[model samples]
Target: MLIKSLPSTWDVEITQAVNGKEALDAYRAGKADVMFLDLTMPVMDGYEVLENIQKEGLNSFVIVVSADIQPLAQERVKKLGAMAFIKKPVNPDLIESALKQYGIAL
Candidate 1:
């Protein structure tokens, strides 16, 4: 539903993963340019995914989108190298801003 709401002008690709492990596997398979990650996902979670990505030196921008708005969680994701931290029920403007920060335009 969210992907459908994105502007058509944006040249983007969408891939769905049921959990972090699948996300990581897709990442390894060259399935994405930028990733929107949910921090509380089952079967590995976002932080573990970020760590694995970093350890493998994957070159992709990751933005953490989660309901966990705790400051410590935000800081932890930042330390793990997430490019942005967006709370759940995300606003389009915030998504736009995050894309712009990474020099991606719609």
Candidate 2:
């Protein structure tokens, strides 16, 4: 769904990770410039991933996409250095707007 949400105007290569661990590994490998992360997953959760990223001083544009819409969750991710927190069941329009708002272009 996220792949479909991306704007047609921008060209990008998409890599899908099954879980947070895989996502973090891909990021470490320099495959992820922009990551759309879920808060829940097997192996490792989104919060841990964010913490690891912060701890390692890695740089990436992280936009957290999750069903957990609690204000605390949003605030936590923000404090952990996520650029944005997007609600689950993502809308294409919102994805586009977020990208533009964060200066994430091709």
Candidate 3:
């Protein structure tokens, strides 16, 4: 549902993943440019994914979408290389604003 809310003008391919591990696999397959990650997931959480990305030095913009809105969680993701953090349930307007703020264009 959140994926459908993204603007058509963004003109990007969307790769859906059911778990953090699958997300990482997709990233490794070159399907991730801007990743919308959920911190809670099975088979590897978003934090672990972020850690792996950092450890592997993968170059991809990550925007964490999570229900855990605590300041510490936000700060942790930033330290792990997430470019932005969006609280869930996601607001499409905020997503667009974040993209613009980061100068991401398709």
lDDT of 3 by residue, 1-106 (tens): 7797686699888899999999999998888889999999999999999999999989969999999989999999999999899998888888998889989883
Which residue pairs collide, candidate 1? none
Alpha carbon deviation, residue 16, candidate 3 (Å): 0.4
Candidate 1 lDDT tens digits, 1-106: 5565455688877999989999999999999888888988899899999999999999968988889989999999999999999887878778887787778877
Clashes of 1: 0
Off by over 4 Å in 1: none
lDDT of 2 by residue, 3-100 (tens): 87789988888899999999999999999889998999999999999999999999968999999989999999999999888898888788889899
Off-target runs (Cα >4 Å) in candidate 3 are: none
Error of 3 at 77 (Å): 0.4
Clash number for each model: 0, 0, 0
Question: In model 2, what are the clashing residue pairs, if there are any?
Answer: none
lDDT of 2: 0.91
* TM-score, per-candidate, Cα-based: 0.92, 0.95, 0.95
